[model samples]
Target chain A: MEKTTHVTSELNINNIKSFLEDIESFIFDCDGVLWRADEAVENAAQTIAFLREQGKKVIFLTNNSTKTRNDFLHKIKSFGIDCNIDEVFSSSYGAQVYLSKINFQQKLFMIGEKGLEEELRPLGLEIIKNFEKTNDGIDNVQHIEPDHSIGAVIIGMDTSYTYQKGVYAHKLLAENPNILFIATNTDPSYPVKNGKSLPGAGSIVTMIATSTGRKPNAIMGKPEQLLLDLILESHSLNRAKTCVVGDRMDTDILFGVRGNTKTLLVYTGVTKKEELPSFEYQPQYDTRTIGDLFTLFQKL
Target chain B: MEKTTHVTSELNINNIKSFLEDIESFIFDCDGVLWRADEAVENAAQTIAFLREQGKKVIFLTNNSTKTRNDFLHKIKSFGIDCNIDEVFSSSYGAQVYLSKINFQQKLFMIGEKGLEEELRPLGLEIIKNFEKTNDGIDNVQHIEPDHSIGAVIIGMDTSYTYQKGVYAHKLLAENPNILFIATNTDPSYPVKNGKSLPGAGSIVTMIATSTGRKPNAIMGKPEQLLLDLILESHSLNRAKTCVVGDRMDTDILFGVRGNTKTLLVYTGVTKKEELPSFEYQPQYDTRTIGDLFTLFQKL
Candidate 1:
């Protein structure tokens, strides 16, 4: 395992104060950093309020594509945190912005849920409609020939993922090499309400990747630059002064490292204290929980 | 990229005569060698007929688990080849034999088609039935706890593979580390009627494997020792006098090498003339077609 740099000491008042002073905006990963599933972490609400009180921009960037932006805002507000729909930046939203920026004019062959479809609706993007309406209905495995009009294939968290969908995506990629293949996120699994995690879009993408022999041209999620770019485009944030806080090292901390922003690792999520040594790129600061940063906020 | 031993000479009359005299039984891969998908190669039927007339025991071995032994026999007969159901050995049959050998008495969690189920019927193995009767029906995503009575999870080619099936398999494996995870074959794709191939058992098994983070305990198919063991147990053949013949090196040819049998490579299928040098275990004999082996039979 590759060794990564580690912050040996716990962030106390002086360290927290300095860290807080250096950053103007805070980007948070929701599932692990803010709360586990639906239950919020201790002092999670307080930490966000404190950051807002200091006039720091708080952005909740999540890779959960199952829900729409409004759904996330509702969930966050339900947790007693002041949030706006615009403050919630999901991978689906990032993909919509990206497609618009590239001026993609072709129809998208979508293999996701209504949330993803809803995201595309705002952009006026046309979609190759699904054959099946619901899981209860027939999969009309129509043996449909490859459609040249379909220039892109987008996939997210789809519970109704079927063989037909995979076959169609494979056919499109096989027919045209230039067809854009984009995935919302590739997180292997996501935590559910019961503490157990379910297979994420990454698994679905992997299945299609195995069948088509083509990887996604772009993964519009954390660790990738697109999500960060989406955040930067919407908010005026100084990269040098911004800090990204998350539990997972691979997606969260690596996202910060790739963007050249400060990163704070919280131990309440996927990453553990013992596993920090094996990381290839360590975060800049380590704390027990997101609430631990409150001591620094108090010092100010 | 590993260099394997290669036989550079084409088998003429003398070489074929000697090769024929040395092998009492011939194990053949059905796809690519004897036939390509449904159509038999130019002289495949004639070669098999000649071998049978010479009193050689021929086995039609395939990894395709979609069809039963009777189905294979019917197809072979349709191709004008003399064959019996007893001569056909599919991966589904291999799994049945393996489970019987291990005295697997517990219920099996089956993720395959009717062909695989038919193979298990003779052994009196009970299966934890799937929730959905068809692909259009509800997946039943039943949150059934791990049933300790289930000892093995067998997977083959299933077009109706769903997220619920993957989740259930993962849960079963997670609940019991000792439970057997058996896959029919891991061939990424298999040839269909149109010369195009569809995702095979390997892809479905891979999806479950990815979600479970556990590789199958046993993969009962070509390239694995279990398939060769099943063939040897059913037939009276001397290892020194047996020749395994096929087109693909990774599965068919490798099976022969691992079983300590001589192998004959045919160029009528997947492995072409240019691919011989790159194999890690090259066949001992090379021929343009199965009909080329007739030169030895003529000498007899």
Candidate 2:
């Protein structure tokens, strides 16, 4: 394989066991490492249970903005994995926390799904408009001048994305240079069933960026420090003893490198073994799957 | 007052007669110079008629894509100006000629008003979809995958632009890297009635560029050399003897500068005297208005 050096340099079972022994807390990415779409990866549930049984703090972190924290908790529980709502750190959840932390008081203009709205609405944050919820006929479309009341623009993935929404957001940002612009995640696309993918939140965010010529102040997702900071905030996580686990090298491994935490790459998701050399940054450790980590637990 | 140097150095009425004596042909930008919105500028008609009486080859050009050549001729006639339809050059007309020059055989996916479609259809070109003509209920929207038959994407201003239309164009360009990407113009916005403006073709084009990460191959409008090329192609224009007259420094004057044509800036619309010095390139001549040129004709 092209990545022979990195592949052969991976920690052996004994080395992995020693590394696990030093880890005081763990952060796990939910999608590719533990489950694909609606199906759980083989032995993934048991592997997490084994880590929890060892008395290590565990948290589920994901960049998927389509789901609320409760939705993630429900999905995680159905996989026979014990996940509290507080342990979930979805991008929408992270956005909610970040907005609250900054004490954002103005009306939030959004180009996102109901999940994102659900996260912000309960906190008493006012949204400028919800096109999907309005369900107005296309004939009812009207050109509105820029409204000065809009204070921030937040974007997430919505199956119902429209040009009118893009225009309204663009006009607002163009009129007010100080508006707080934020995107929940910038993943190029997300995998669907049958190995197909749909344009992700990042693509939608890009549309807004192209229109307004402005980048988001914060992208609340993996590889961005905001999510990591939120995960460690409540848990009092020690970066030196924290191990971040995920399937993708770009989002997960790079996330760990940036945070100074150990990272383990599982092959059950996006990245392949042969693709390692192509990346400028490599994971600290990589194995066949999340279940492979069980060997370390058995040895302990 | 800020542009005093450029203004003072500009040819006076006596000097203007000498300058006009050498001009064999002229390309005139329509809006803001000869007219503002739907109203003609004072003496604009007589100035142009005087130029024609001097046996000068004159062409009426505009970057506005909302009108066809016939539409322009009609508007010009309404202004009490004798103009031939063949002497009018609109962004839509330029796009039609460009596609024909390239021998384009595949269907064009358009994001524009009916005027754009009207120009291309007469040239035996087929359009993929018209967002306005469909008149489908917005609630009945469905996602259709990229169609390979779409060989080019052409964008202009469209009040009916939808997110679905933007995504479809993006997917086509993303999937087929070689698909000819073209836009009518990149004017940030177009002026409407009551001194207001709305987002223009550039905004819609920017959305696709942001989504696909590709700039247009040909933006068929002012400030680009393509339009100048089109103007000169039929007339066998001598760049040295050709004079370009307009009101805006950014588009019209810049177009002339880039094309190596002598340019005359009229202060009737858009660019004010204070804004001229900010431009790196200056027009060769400046006057109070287009009617000021008629004074040169009278002196002769």
Candidate 3:
């Protein structure tokens, strides 16, 4: 990989080329820029192929905590893109890393689905269901009381949401306000097929936070510096070389900008073209569309 | 009713007695103190009966926008309490009063349900329903756009929520940014049969405010002082002799304290027993429970 250092206060075409030269590793956001609503961007496969040919490693990063790395890899491969499970990083995995580093010892009360449980199980974390039900005699469980032995409460999207879950989370949160309240991401809505959408884990997290007078300790996803730091540490790469590409400015572009990496704002995602000027912080490169990625790669 | 005034900063039994003696009109809050999880308070019926015998005027004041005055009266009567529709005041009703006073001429783009419509329709206000169905491509209406001619956008809880509504609201908000965004209440959650619930209008209203970067022009509900002013204006009652009795310190008691009415905190609502001392503005009377209201009346 070519090593070049270029810095400009604003986005320019030359800086984009300089970024590609210096960065041996590329982190691409999946939801909006690569594939939106169920359809992959026209140049997604070509861009990935060009990156592989250039001897540059590509990692698919997603804040969608609903899917596992293997699941994501399978989905990407089906879209005519080649990626292994190890090349994909999800917020659920990042959350697991966060939990392992903390000194929580209580039974983990999770407000998430199977993907989250799959991530936390290997850490020897005990899952406690219905803390309120167990305490109120509605259900029988060994751990009825909340004490130091209770580890932490993790929140994420659960399609099978119930009032009991909220009640339990509220009670556990109230008991130990210091207990870890970790959420996967802060995205309020997730894109669905047929132009429909569902409230993401962040909405539930907000509800819990508002009910209890506490905020999450850490959000293990994009826009949070922790995940970027972890990726950098694992790859043994400096921030100057890595280029972050995504569709949303608030989350993806923000991650790159704040992480001191070259940021590319692709037009194939959640954010619209008209909303760019209003942003306080602009991205390093503003491509008309992600289809231009192949043209830029050819020029480079 | 006694017209005794005790101007003492320190709270004592003598002052509490004096304050209680001066209470001719009583304002009660719904949800928590009146009922907990669909169960009416044990003394609710008897207390209302005793107040009626004393020939004291009573009003049921609530920040809950889900029900109309008739709905509340019916619900209260179902719970074995005698109450009139005229004696109930809601934030929706307050919004109607505010809108009528402003003399807005154009049709209203309402983001609320039946209760809100019922309150606004009597004032000859035209309710714009097409904003709610923008996704269906029903663009027959000439004034589809939310402009200066489109008087205001009234926001309240609507079970029929959609992204299309959000988009239309955003469009109107972006165009007129000055167009009124009136929210019914700011309570983040409402007590349900199970526990505290989400999808409250407060969350939706907050989302719109955060997205548009503008606070609503006014919140016509408890704690806003608008509703209190309306109550006093309609009933021709003096704030000095009016006692606001409710379970929530933040909403009911805060209103009373700010409006210069005698505030009473009943320990049967959103606030717990231990949380009273932490409040910056204290209530005049802190009863152990709503049952103590009868005892307070007896003492007076």
> Per model, how many backbone clashes are there?
0, 1, 5
Residue pairs of candidate 3 with colliding backbone atoms: A23-A241, A106-A149, A106-A150, A106-A151, A107-A151
| Estimated TM-score for each candidate | 0.91, 0.80, 0.68
Q: The CA-based lDDT of model 3 is what?
A: 0.71
Collision pairs in model 2: A163-B163
lDDT of 3 at B266: 76
Candidate 2 residues lying further than 4 Å off, grouped into runs, are A1-23, A36-43, A77-80, A130-143, A187-199, A212-218, A222-224, A240-300, B1-22, B38-43, B77-82, B130-143, B193-196, B214-217, B244-254, B263-300
Off by over 4 Å in 3: A1-16, A103-106, A128-150, A194-196, A291-293, B1-24, B30-56, B62-221, B224-241, B257-300
lDDT of 3 by residue, A62-171 (tens): 99787677778888888899888777888989987877777555578887767778887778868875445533112222133454456577887655444446555666
* Candidate maximizing DockQ: 1
* Model 2 lDDT per residue over A26-108, tens place: 89998898898779998888888888888889999989887788988999999999888888888998889999999888889
Q: Write the per-residue lDDT of candidate 1 for residues B102-190, one digit (tens) a residue.
A: 88898899888778889988888678757443232112332434567788999887766666666667678765789999999988765
Which candidate gets the maximum TM-score versus the true structure? 1
**lDDT string, candidate 3, B58-164, tens digits:** 88898877677888888888878889887889999888889888877677877776788888888886787444343221122112345446667777765454434
Q: Kindly indicate the candidate among 2 and 3 with the higher lDDT.
A: 2
